[model samples]
Target: MTIYLLRRLFLLGTVLLGLSIFAFSLGYLFPGDPLQNFSGLRYLDDSTREQLTLAYRLDGSYLQQYLAFIQRLWHGDWGLSLASQQPLLTEIRQVLPATLELTSYALLVSFFVGIPLGILAAIKPDGVIGKAISAIAITGYSLPIFWWGLLLIMVFAVGLGWFPSGGRLGVLYEIPPQTGFMLVDILLSDVSYRQAALQDALRHLLLPTLALATFPTTVMIRFVRDAMLDVWEQSYIKTAKAKGLSRLQVLYRHGLRNALLPVIRQIGLQFSTLITLAMLTEVIFSWPGIGRWLIDSIYQRNFPAIQAGLMIISVLVITVNMLTEILHTFFNPLARKR
Candidate 1:
């Protein structure tokens, strides 16, 4: 297992190296001078452009620039955002937690809700409950994320006023940021009305989380259902049943562990999609997160922020895939033997 882990780690490093190179090269080759976004200033002059270009190291060859970027990355310097003139990492730090918090909650919703529906559907594939689950999954999968978010906001926030329209928390809550995660921050803070603050945070979180979770939940349901069905047909499943094992016992004790291998792999594989969907969900719901930050950077042509966001998100996606692969191997004895 140790050797396998080491090998996977090495492979992950290689994948990240390639991803960095691709992202950097794409950013470098992006059409438009880095200073062009600043060219509209009344007092901006040629020397200023030259100075800005030099400051950004645009004066160097592409290879030289890439090497500098690699060195900076190695030293944990993510560069400065042209928009804010602050460290890109600092800006990311402020926004990343919001995305993480939202995505985590969304994943929880998907896992808890989707898995059970999937199990029921698998148990009774042609039954009314199974058909209902299938219909729900299809609808969830087919709905556009922005549309779903808007529909949710209109119904829950606009019509019923059950939740706030946007933002992470109510301004009334003055929770200090220890972890940057709003829920955790609220729980850890010494603020008065902490319970109310936490509730407000959750209320704000609910709409976006549901919208972000929709597609992933559907995907999980389908994957789980299919995996369970496949596992249920295996010879061992029949043997367990014939041995007088109860249906639930056979399903839980023998079937589920095997079924979960596919689900586990899909979770990792679908992580990037989840992140992408979260970005759209954030935009629709006006949630403050890296997705919104990246959109603003693109509009402002903040190359450093754009590059850094790409690198960070890519690394996250790659890391998730690696972890899922490891889990998949660990769970599957056949994989271990191979």
Candidate 2:
């Protein structure tokens, strides 16, 4: 196990090295001068230009620039955001939790909800209940997330007024950030109308959560249903049934646990992707998450922010993938053997 983990760590380091190169090269590889794009200034005086060039190490060769970039990163310097002129890491810290909260809500909804529906579907795939779940899941999975978000906003937020269209909270609730998660922040703060603040947060959360979760929930339903069905066909499942075990007992005790090993892997795979995928939903809802932050940075041509975002997001995605792999290997005997 230790040897396997070490191998995985080496692989992770190799991938990070490659990703860093790709991220670092973007400034030079792209058409526009990064400084001009970031600075938004038509002309730069020689002294200012020289300073900027030195700061970003644009004056150096690619290898030298990359080494400087790594050195600065080693010292915990992620560069300054051109838009805010603050450390890029500091800006990320403010927004990343929002993305995590939003994505976490969506994941919870999908996991708990999808697994039961999947088991039900597996039990009676041809029945009306099963057919209904399958149809809804397929349709939800098929639709584009942005379009789905808009459709939801129209019906729930605009037409029906059941929920807020966008943002984290109503202007009435001035809850200061205790933790980045809005719900937790609401709970922790000594705001007036505290319960109301939380209710507003949920209302603001619903539409975006629904839109973001649709794809994953639907996918989970199909995946779980299929996995459970496959598990039920195994000889052990038949043996349990032959032993006169109740249908429910066999399904729960003998089937679900085995099915879940793969489910863990699937959900972990979805983890990083959902964060990046939230970009569209974030834009439509105007939620202040990493996705929206990155989008705004791009619009402002804040190349430093862009670069930081790329590197940060790359690390997150790669780290999640690596963890998923380790988790899968840990759970599956066949994988561990390989």
On lDDT, the leading prediction is 2
lDDT tens per residue, model 1, 222-320: 989999999999999999999999999999899988888777787776677888988888888888999988988889877667778888898888899
Question: Candidate 2 residues 44-67, lDDT tens each?
Answer: 799988886797577778787788
Rate residue 105 of model 2 by lDDT: 94
**Candidate 1: regions farther than 4 A off:** 1-3, 32-63
Model 2: colliding residue pairs: none
Candidate 2 stretches with Cα past 4 Å from truth are 34-60
Q: Which model scores highest in TM-score?
A: 2
Return the lDDT, model 1, position 133: 96
For model 1, what is the alpha-carbon lDDT of residue 183? 91
lDDT of each: 0.84, 0.85
